[model samples]
Target: MIIPAIDLIGGKVVRLFQGDYAQKTEYSASPQDRFDLYVSEGARYLHLVDLDGARDPAARQLETIASLIKNTPVPVEIGGGIRSRKDVEDLLNIGADRVVIGSCAVKNPTEVKEWFRDYGASHIVLALDINIDPVSGKRFIAVKGWQENSGVTIEDLIADYREAGLRYVLCTDISKDGTLKGTNVALYTDLHREFPDISFIASGGIGSLDDVRNTAQSGAFGVVLGRALLEGKFTVKEALECWPNA
Candidate 1:
């Protein structure tokens, strides 16, 4: 599915350049307003991220999340500041279709695995944000809202979750995110080949319809349109038409 992303910072819709908080640009429209627009344009899924919650799981933007959920008709998968079972339950109770676990997945695999088992893989997503070392060309996972490195390799985490029966994964290359450059198609292709059983959704650095086409051709389960969609690089309708099965 061509998932639309609504990133929340201070209860307002915003997009950060390369995951830098200081480099963010705020959109005047409310989250509800954007969600309504996307829904009208044939959006089947929404990728909602709580920036505040990501900085500190204790500071989840529940009110904002609730408002978006109440206003939109489509299924919403939420991420950021989701650390415990209660956090997951609260979101699911409030109508979140799926809860994304990031930092905690790396910090406490055992707890997260239990959550995956209890909640079922279909209701959970493993948000793996990573950055590739320029010189070495090795990928390392990032945590704490992509501010800190977890020292864990992306491959290792994927392997860790494979045993837990993880069904969905949202992989974002921090360097490519919000840049409007293009997606890392080669990376996603390799991932699809490595984990043929998992559904991998590509995020970050998508600037055009061609990027979306490339992802669909790369065997990705879906693609998250962020800056490209917000900047009018392409419309949600066009995206849907390009990948009807997305």
Candidate 2:
């Protein structure tokens, strides 16, 4: 599936270069307009991130997100600054199909696992941002809006969650994110092969239709389109066409 993504900062649609807040670009389109546009263009699912909430949970834009969810007909998954059960509950209560847990999941795996049990695996999605060491070729998980390295390997984290019935995982390659270069096909390919039961959603560096094709062929269940879609590099319909049976 070609899942369209909208990153929000102060209720405005925006995108950050490599997850850096200082290097941000805000789009003129409102979140509602962008959502409607994606729906019109054949997007089946949507990903929303609250940049404000990501930096500070207390500043979460719940009212704005709730309004968007109330209007969206398709499944919408929301993330950013989701650190507590109340945060997850608030999103789900407001009609979010899935609540994506990132830094909290890394900081408190036990607590997150309980959430999967309480909410069911289908209702919870784990967002793991990865940083690869250029010299050692090791992948480490980054948390807190990609500001802190958790010092935990992706393999270990997923393995731990697999026991708790983990269903969906959104994995992003920080190096390629917002760069418009290409996706980390090899990473998703290896992950898909290793954890065939989990639905892995590949994110970051989706620049062209061919990137979508490669991701689909990599066995990823879905791909999140951000900058490429926002910049009109291609439409959601064109991206879906590149994936067989999407």
Superposition error at 188 for model 1 (Å): 0.6
Q: Which 10-residue span in candidate 1 carries the lowest summed lDDT?
A: 237-246
lDDT of each residue in 1-246, candidate 2, tens digit only: 889999999999999999889999999999999999999999889999998998888999999999999898899999998999999998999899999999888899999999999999999999999999899878899986788889998889999999999999999999999999999999999999999999999999999988999999999999999999999999999998998777
| Candidate 1 lDDT by residue in tens digits, 163-202 | 9999999999988888888899988899999989989999
Q: Name the runs in model 2 displaced over 4 angstroms.
A: none
**How accurate locally, in lDDT, is each candidate?**
0.89, 0.93
**What's the lDDT for candidate 1?**
0.89
Give the candidate number with the greatest lDDT: 2
Worst 10 residues of 2 by lDDT: 137-146
